[model samples]
Target: MLAVQHCNNSALHVDEGFSNQTQQVLGVAPVRCRENLNTTTNPTAAGLSMTLGIVSNIIALIILAKAYARLRKRSKATFLLFASSLVATDLAGHVIPGALVLRLYISGTAGGLCNQSDATCHFLGGSMVFFGLCPLFLGCVMAAERCMGVTRPLLHARMVCTAHTKIVLVMIWLLALSVALLPFFHLGTYIYQFPGTWCFINVLDNTSITDVIFVLLFSGLGLAALAVALVCNTISGVTLVIARLRKKKCHRRSAKSHDIEMVAQLVGIMVTSCICWSPLLIFGLMSVIRSYSGSMGDDLETYRTLMVMGVRLATWNQILDPWVYILLRRAVLKKIYRITTGRSDLKGSTFRRWEISSFQNSMKSVINRN
Candidate 1:
């Protein structure tokens, strides 16, 4: 989360230099148009989004930690740790960069709060990239872990020990950090976008090799991760369906429902993530390609609204991720619901007791449906 804001000064300086000339030539004030958009829509949307995101992410972290604590020794595995890491990253995203966005909403301009050389701008940009990419990379890792669990159960169990999980997590953060900090080191560049509410790598601003490389890394890696997640999830879902069909001949209904539910949940999560991110990924790639061919500037100016919309859509992914996890964990969610509604069995207990084997059983259930 700390690496997202490592923006370069080039785009910021250039945009500011051209602000007046651009308005005069185009007969439309670019900054004023953006300010109008922000004044009308940013406060309401940013307020709701940040408020909800912060609260939900905190709740998710608590619930997930509680669930992890309740798991019996037999249920403890690398997946729980990976899951916790993902949640923590999402929480940081909301707490750190999301807070900065709220501040920008209040300050109302990149000039005062996010000057080119401002530490606040750099921090926000770096954290945004770090948190955003952490999820994408971690999502891929989670898919691979699930795939191995389904296809090579024995090998997966033996290889993915606690130490290996920790190592993998450390590697993930290191890589995310390296990518996020590249702009600060001058390997690439970062800049505030048109609206001044956020900053990120200036992928659409130039045609340099550094820009293309970063753009490809950002969009390509994300798309690839989503693809892997989709494929792996589909394979696991099909395997579960086959198991269900085989068991149905023996008159087992319970496992059938569980299998169906698991498949639906996996498909739903993958689909939602794809829908939320696909537009930004597509437009980002298009921008890179067109910029390389010297045909991007006019198109970008013409479709600035669409580009901003893509960024807005991408922002929702981090917010929605934790909810997906919580919703999928039916038992945990039930416990939370009960507690919130004052109907919990252990009203004053510090921890809610859950069946230790539930999560383990959930993973192994596809193979143990009988």
Candidate 2:
């Protein structure tokens, strides 16, 4: 800890590197963090991350509120309701540590309190692992659900039992959390290194087998989630397309169309997940597995730097989440329109609705190709 002037008559122990140093506050010491590092060209990725986070939370909150109002009576499992939990966790994973880092960064890079000791780190660590896993696996589970719904409507409707859905969802979250923490409990901590943040724990400094294991384990997890999302999304798209073509002669076309809508949204969800995390996931595996895989160490620092950037980009998910809701779930945008306008915006011309629908379909097709 370093001593700097206080707003009051007294001076205080504060990390000065992150601060503008223009003024002081009473009894408040600025937390030191890595954000003091140069971000001149970066737009304070943390700041952008925060803005994205705020927007997403607002959108999600709006959607949930509207959904509660609209389907207030329906106890069925809707995407908005189920995905809300994931949204909450993602917000925490992205925001809590991000805020802390920004604070420390502005205070001064030299030193500051980080995680109130190791226990706190574990909490953040566990939170990151838990939340990160929940979204990806949930996407996969969701894809399976969509496939059943479109491919086997009767079975899908019957299988929509609350008990089963709840059980599967809970298990998914638990398994993801457990998988993330195995390395930590076995030996060390999971770490995070973005452009301006490093949560979980300090990295490579420990150099224990446990540390390396945790790194591989978490990275592997990220990669797995991305892969599952891609494969499931592709299959879901193809399956839905086939189902629609086969049922063209029946009056079930509209129903089939709705099924396709759901599938497209599900695919969009996974595509977004893949785009957000794939780069980091790929590089993370290489870094962790290099010892066993071939050599690429001639540019280790470059790769490390790339890993940092990739992880930062991965966080785009949190920021993009609100937009995702608006596009993928009708509930969110409807609410946004209603709240902002004194009247309903859904009463647009038939042409407008068709346009919106067409845009969504095109986006799904393109995202699927990616």
Candidate 3:
């Protein structure tokens, strides 16, 4: 009986010991968590970025909406359709992620949203993927559209009607959506980016199969699209320059200045689009290569800084694209002025009509020359 009592007492002591150990572990957990929180995020920087993104996207959206309002049903061009689609993606990419970041920043939490695998994290990551790619692909489509307009004017006119453009836009969005959702389905992973401002695909200096496959595939596809766009833009620009030169050679004094200006404008759009997207993609490819080869080096700080800068640069595309559209499309600018000044002047309407007519006349000349 004494032995039995001792056994029961021993069991009680063991239970108490295990409970004490658990309590100690629990006590240490919060401290470790606090340390992690402090290290992972720069809340001030995040807030600043989010605020800027929010404000910029808002202004861009307002301008686009006002301008889109002015497009008469008969004048809905493919370029305008694609521009509207670009605005939608920019809105989603900037506003949604920016709002979430602001919420987390204001709540005074650090690092990720909730835990790493939480709903908010997935949403932000997926959104960053979707909206990030949307503009790029849409830009390519628009570039291709322009190429068609310049190179195959009759076919482009027949094929790229308003309904056809809408169908193409739908397809582009669906493709981007599919790619973005891959991470959520375990094909890839999305983790909180450093300084904890945003989330992106696995861009660490180490690689997994998923990371390698996704990065290479998407980067290849994106680069191909960008390349196609660059080529199209080059061809279109050269064609325009040649056309302008031919007109100058003929000594057609009328509208020669406008032709030169328009050619310059098209070249600028092409150059700007390429400049905005190229660095991030190139850096992303290099990072992936280094990760696979295990040559990432000891300077994680450099890698982190470069990654942050690359992301910011990529985001500049979203911010700048609307302004590019506004500056290049005279109709959009006219609408903005009218909206801002609340101008109901007949002169404004007539002037806009004249601008549209002039653009049509220019397009016809280009086609005829080609």
Candidate 4:
């Protein structure tokens, strides 16, 4: 009986030690444990959200694959490749992290697993950062590619091949991965966030200078990418407009139409990204500045709630991105136009006149040269 009592005491001591370690590592107070547990009480909602994201991304991927197969022989294949990569990345973003969350929920531990396992927390946190930034980077790359193609067609055609684009995509992935891994190198740190559903870079009221810098770097890169995309898309759109106005008829109708389709898609992508991601990026900047300034004392909880909302908003970007390409195609738009306007042959009639004018101009030039 005495031996069993001693064994019970030892077990109790070990439990206390484990609890202390978890509290220290997670930087969560004992008072907040109940709150975190409560957050997971409705695992059905979280599971459903994850399920929707995963399924939407999977559907987008299938559509993109079909679209890519159709365009694989064209010069526009490069843009499709980029779009496909972005969708695939977003799919992974949803699947890997969603699986982890669901697993924790199923195990009935919810956030407890992350509180206990530093490796799991870091991996989840890094993935959040990595996936969050990759789409922004890829958007910027696509915008720049389209800008170059529109503004400097000769130069763009000479360069920017499929092999080079693949290399660029790999480089962008590495860049985002490097940023995500920075916390592991002591540049900053990841900690269990409020309600403890997942881990992310620490941006709480007690965030350190390094943490502030890390958050700033993330938001800054994302915002910069958006800004660059805006500028490039604007320039590409203007160039296309000017070219169309200056040359009412062109022999390269197919190429011109392709450029227009690409620019329209880029515009849709830029708008969707800005709408979905700006909230989180801006909130991140504000949180870090407020934390660094020591001015978030009374409003800490408010800011935390905002951060959670911002993250939810950002996640929608992945879901909406693929639809931009899927529905923004010229064929799709023309069909919609036909349905609404009751003019099935409007585009063909309009383009036929331009084609005849272009052929006449070609003949005139040839006859004058002769």
The lDDT of each candidate is 0.64, 0.56, 0.62, 0.76
Model 2: which residue pairs collide?
A: 16-108, 17-108, 17-109, 18-105, 18-106, 18-107, 18-108, 19-106, 19-107, 32-112
Residue-level lDDT of model 1, residues 1-370, one tens digit each, is 2111212223344354477588679896444223312332235566677677777777778876776675523324455677678778877777777667666656755433232335666677688768767887777787777667766767987787777888988999998898888877776566665555566666555557887788788788788879998888888777766665876587543232323334444455567678767887777777767777787756765444555667677778777877887787656556687778777575443223223223446667556654
TM-score of model 3 relative to the true fold? 0.73
Please provide, for model 4 over 1-370, each residue's C-alpha lDDT reduced to its tens digit, 9 standing for 90 to 100.
0000000111122244566678778996633232344422445665666666667767777877887797665557899899889988988887887777667656755454322327777888898899999999999999999999888877987799989999999999999999999998887788766556677787874678998889989889999999999999999998888776666565443335667888999999899999988988898889888988898888887887877778877877877887887788766776787788788676455444444554564566458668
TM of each candidate vs. truth: 0.75, 0.68, 0.73, 0.83
How many residue pairs clash (N, CA or C atoms closer than 3 angstroms) in each of the candidate models, in the order given?
12, 10, 0, 0
Model 4 misplaced stretches (Cα beyond 4 Å): 1-31, 113-117, 248-255, 347-370
Residue 210 CA displacement from its true place in model 2, Å: 2.9
lDDT computed for candidate 1: 0.64
Winning model by lDDT:
4
Question: How are the candidates ranked when ordered by TM-score, highest leading?
Answer: 4, 1, 3, 2
Model 4 quality (TM-score) = 0.83
Q: For model 4, what is the alpha-carbon lDDT of residue 199?
A: 75
Give the per-residue lDDT digits (tens) of candidate 3, residues 131-205.
767877887787787777766767876787888888988999899899889876677677666555466777663
The deviation in Å at residue 285 for candidate 3 is: 2.2
Comparing 2 with 3 on TM-score, the higher-scoring candidate is 3
